[model samples]
Target: MEQHKYSISKWCTVSEEVVKRFDQVVFEGEKGDFVAFAKAYYKTNEIDYPKFFKMDALSKLAFIGSECLLMDEEFDKPTSDIALLFSNASSSLDTDLKHCESIIDKDSFYPSPAVFVYTLANICLAEVSIKHKLQSENAFFVTPSFDGDLMYTQVKYILETHRAKQVLCAWVEYLEGKYKFFGYMVGSYRQGELEHTRENIKEIYRR
Candidate 1:
């Protein structure tokens, strides 16, 4: 058996602070609820996408994380050749609760199409794909926790099997009023890149 090495071209973490490539403090805003933080991050950063406001909390987190992860990185392949692999524990529970509440009261049941559309966790993947114009393979998983082996294996397979030239991996989880997003890019080796391994993935997630 042999192992193939891939590089983590870049990564981003969005929580109380926005850290890019591990330690660079790109933006740090006042601590607040997820909704407030998302709004402040988007507005303060001047991300020119008005559609962001329409997305659900999970999608919004994924969108913002993807935005910071893919910033200024040139891809060698077309957008269609990039694959998205995202996993989270909450699995869109935040939006699911909203949708559930809408239908729970039959007397006043009025489901908004907007709210119903984001019931699935994978919808966040779609939101990111649409925003970045990525037409490549994308999948989302719900795990008990952030599985580093899952992230490493899935990303490695995507690269080795030629399903994509580059793979964007993320662990975007949002439930209730808490959120954490960790995203990274895995691809062929490049200068100053971190090797894509299970340990590395866990380390980055912890950071």
Candidate 2:
């Protein structure tokens, strides 16, 4: 298997001031529009509301990771063989709860098929591709817990045998109105350049 260039960023950062323990995290804003949610949480010069480019924490992870890849002036738009390999601990728990709530609210039993589709964690990647026009193979991995070794191996195989030029990978887990997004912008250019060790990933999430 080949290696790739990797860059990472963590957001919706919880303040270390008011809280001492880091087991649980809290968001700074309530849900309305996620791009606006992102704007309120992180600072970036490329952001414009109309651009409304990145929505949801998972999308935000891809947006920031994509920015890192697009940074190389020599690189061009990824044409094909781009794969989205992602792993999550909670596995769309937030969206699942939303779907359940919609059907179980008693007063409102209508289930919009659209919302139901997004209830899958894989929808995050689909949304990213639609937002950025990436027509490539994609996959989502759900695990009982975070395992960096498993994620790294999946990405490597995807790139080698699956012919994926890039793997926008992340550990995005959401639960109880809380979310944490940690993405590694992995690709052909930065092969063997990243330390995808368990400790490193744990550090990424401050876990």
Best by TM-score: 1
TM-score of each: 0.92, 0.64
Query: lDDT per residue, candidate 1, 49-109, as tens digits?
Result: 8889999988988988888877675655548778999999989889989999888987998
Model 2 alpha-carbon miss at residue 25, Å: 17
- lDDT values, one for every candidate: 0.84, 0.55
lDDT of 2 at 81: 53
**Sequence-dependent TM-score of model 2:** 0.64
Q: Residue 161, candidate 2: how far off, in angstroms?
A: 2.1
User: What is the model-wide C-alpha lDDT for candidate 1?
Assistant: 0.84
- Clashes by residue pair, model 2: 3-191, 4-187, 4-190, 4-191, 5-190, 81-165
Model 2 poorest ten-residue lDDT run: 13-22
Model 2, position 53: C-alpha lDDT score: 42
